[model samples]
Target: MSYRLPARPRARFSYTRWQQRFAPYLFVSPFFILFLVFALFPLLFSLYLAFHLWSPLDGLGNWKFVGFENFALALGAQDLFWQTLKNTVWIGLLAGVPQHLVALPLAFVIHQSLRRYQSTLSTILFLPYITNAVAIAIVFATLYSERLGLLNYARGAFGLDPVRWLGDPGMVPYSVAAVVFWRYLGWNVVLYLSGLQAISEDVYEAATVDGAGRWQQFWYITLPLLRPMMFYAFTLTIVGNMQLFEEPFMLLNDGGGSGGAGLTTAMHIFNTAFRDLDLGYASAMSWLLFLAIFALSMVNNLLFSRGGER
Candidate 1:
């Protein structure tokens, strides 16, 4: 005769099918609730503000309706808006493109030739990205000063004249771009290194067996495989470089230096909101800037996307 086990009694809050289906959601509910309260409400309110004229001094009820005046003012009335947009894009491209260019090769070199010192080298390169932008910008500003600056001093040592790094409009972009490049190069390197690690070693071995040289293998196999990583990196760089404000703000004493050559669209927006105290107008400008960012990002996506499945 076989002895049968007794029935397992279910508790009031038993782990039933419904509970199992929603337990994960219940565990994560706090984040979604907070996000709705904080992020979603502010974004919707900002959209509302973009269409109305009002100040914090004026009560929320007193916000006067204004049809596209704010947009027109941002796009047409402000010379600095246009200039800042141009500067932002130029500086972003100069710094951003080279970041990947330098990082890819540097990462490849480290992965291939200097595997022993990879960690040490990566840390050193990545230091600048992790450092405070304000502090680093101040240091870079000191180095860039026209007289008695490290950069100018080095030039003089080589029998060159002291170039106005911050003063001259034409030179300003390059100076800012150089700092941006220096700050972000290592970040790109790290991204590429991680991507390289994700690539299977057997693929490289196969290429080698087929008598593919290093450059050929890299161009044909590695780059194609790294496209996804490249897309991610490119999107980050595009968004980041478009929103450049802090480094230039600190370096130029909060207004992008003389002539506003280094002034980014982000800085212009900040000035519009705080300096001019046109909250409503600034909100509109912000939306427009966001649209521009979306457009560019879409364009980037189009360029980076491959048609066929790999």
Candidate 2:
């Protein structure tokens, strides 16, 4: 009786408390909801579809379960899949390796020698990264033309023959890779520049007091400190270049242009899904490509970790 009804249980939560606890989630719910519908659900559905055979014409729920048939066919001795895979890897290397090599040195020079012009230089460099891929690809397609292109014009000025930038099978990958390089190079430069900026000037000052010359300071101090950033940049380049699609697609067109030299794995999967209407096969190919990317990432991780430990 003295308990006096135990204070009526306080309604478990006051209105203000409920609002404070859940208001943030309420605000963020739209993103999660849209992600579930657009990304997660589709990803799950694609995984399901990877094991089944169905065309858009057959409608949903009419899929025939085919186990790993889709995967088998993709990984089989089919020249298209393997050839495209080779092209993807080759272009990835062509674009990615030079990107870091150039970006690192460029960022270092700008950071050390051109501090006054850093902002202007960064803005100029970053423009390509933000430019619309399709628009730039169209411009580059013209520049890459076998004749009457600016690049050919430049070559003519140098008394060299016009190079087939996108025409020849051997040249097509390089052409696509160059466009990829131009677009992503600035991104890596910005990343390296940020990492360079984060480094303490006091450390450099101390090195200077220790009689470290510019090259010595850069070699011993800057390079070691920049290892983390280098790893991060390398990883990004690996992931992006491995999955490259748009520039090659737009510049080379749907069939990946002459001899399918510019045909990436993404383009192949796209053709399988939309053109052939083989959603299952496309999903399987996508997963395989994903695995390839994952493996390479792991290899990169291993290399970085080993270097760090050493």
Candidate 3:
């Protein structure tokens, strides 16, 4: 004989339908409230400010509506906008590419070969990421100093002359990029490590049984599967490096040292708004940089997606 369970009674205080229907919203109301107060309001305010000529020194009442004159000035004839953009891109590319190159193999080796010391190695790599950029830049500034720096001392020990890492315009980009690379190298390694963890060990064992070597397994199995993570890491590096300011700023000072070779778009924008008090023009340049970043990210997505399909 089969036994039947009794049905439970509904609570008398509960609403028939409406309360149940709005339950999810009740649970998430705090997030919506925060989004409105913090994110949405600031974005809208910035957009409004972008189209108006106003200064921090001037009151809100002083805002004057200027159509696209600011945009025209940023795009049409401002030579510094283009020059700083070129510098930003050059430093970004130089620093960004090697991050992934070094991170992938380093992560894989730690994941597979050095399993016993994995945690310790990851913590060491992650230390640089957690260190303050300004502080690190200050340290690098000392390292780049010509006569008394450790870098120069090491070169002199080898009978080679000290190269001017900071003073010369030609060497400034490399110096800045080097600092950028060092700061983010461990971050990319951590990202790659996460991706590596998601890959199954069983698959590697199966590949090994089929006479696949480490290199072959990496090429055919690991990389193809890690495409999504690789894309994410690459995109982050691009955006962060493109907007680079702090390291260069602290290392080279506001004037970009020597000949402004280390000057980035973000630093230039800051100078325009603060140093020159050109709020309207700076706002326009900011919007223009945002557009460039958005476009480049879109291109990155397309390229990665297409590559994954193949």
The TM-score between candidate 3 and the true structure equals 0.88
lDDT of 2 at 205: 96
Candidate 3's residue-wise lDDT over 223-288, tens digit each?
988999999999998899889999989998888878899999999999988998878778888889
- Clash count list over all predictions: 0, 0, 0
Local accuracy of candidate 1 as per-residue lDDT tens digits, 13-112: 6578768899889989999999999999988887888888988777678898898887888789545677888999999999998999989988988987
Collision pairs in model 1 = none
- Candidate 2 lDDT over 1-310, as tens digits, reads 4655555555665789989999889999999999999999999999999999999999879999999998899989954788889999999999999998899889989999999999999999999999999899889988988787999999999999998888888899889999999998999999999999999999999999989988898889888899889888988888888788899899988788888999999999999999999999999998999899899988888887864462
Candidate of highest TM-score: 2
Which portions of model 2 miss their true places by more than 4 Å? 1-14, 307-310
Full-model lDDT, candidate 2: 0.90
Ranking by TM-score: 2, 1, 3
Of the candidates numbered 1 and 3, which has the greater lDDT value? 3
Error of 1 at 203 (Å): 1.3
TM-score of each: 0.89, 0.93, 0.88
Ranking by lDDT: 2, 3, 1
Error of 3 at 218 (Å): 0.9
